[model samples]
Target: MTRTPASRRDDYPVFRRLQTRWMDNDQYGHMNNAVHYALFDTAVNGWLIEEGLLAETGAEAYFLVAETGCHYHSELAFPGWVDAGLRIAHLGTTSAVYHIGLFAEGSGTAAADGRFVHVHVVRGTHRPMPIPEAARQVLARLFPAA
Candidate 1:
């Protein structure tokens, strides 16, 4: 079954503004398909870092992307900015599923939407590990009420 894309910016609880690079566009004159995943990765990890849940290095644990998929509703190209809207769809012991909506600046509907799954792992061994309590608390803030 196909899922409908989020139709409003307010569907997400957090937003991250990203400047689109000219290089992000493909010969088709639109952002490359792969670039959507890059934006999703940047939005989620950047938020984690901002919340003190992740570090560039020397952290006890960190998250690694396990799965990701995107659905496009409209086109996005360079020479513009993207507002990535983020929320936690599922938060488990060792992983979380992040839902993201990519909206063209000032647009209420998402140009694209996707899910990114991150699994917490030990820094050195990379073994699966429970998400840190501190991180969980912070992530919980992104959970929208059902």
Candidate 2:
């Protein structure tokens, strides 16, 4: 497979600042690879909540991750922060792809970057459903034209 380069923070329109805990680091002296995926999940879900598209209570529809991937460019260690940048790569009726860049605080290049594809599903049935208009409106802001 062809290698993709790491993204810059500015390439994404939204960002969430996340701190690295001491426990996040591994015996190797750097943040664990699994932690990167956790950060990506947290960033996306946090943005959804911030946009009022997700609720702890009864939400119109819930999203389930269908796919996810990451490419690490550098190391992240404890005792610092990460600014996770988010953007929409593709938007579909019931599914959407989110691009995430994990940049060390104040760094211009990404330490790691990834993609997540979420499918909107019914609350009870857990079956795929069309994305709500309100959610769509919020997600559209991640697009460049918006």
- The lDDT of model 2 is 0.91
TM per candidate: 0.93, 0.93
**For residues 81-123, what per-residue lDDT tens digits would candidate 1 score against the true structure?**
9999999999999999999999999999999998999999988
Superposing every Cα of model 2 onto the true structure, what RMSD results? 1.5
Q: What is the model-wide C-alpha lDDT for candidate 1?
A: 0.91
User: Candidate 1: lDDT of 64?
Assistant: 89
Stretches off by above 4 angstroms in model 2 are none
Q: What's the number of clashes in each of the models? A: 0, 0
Error of 1 at 139 (Å): 0.4
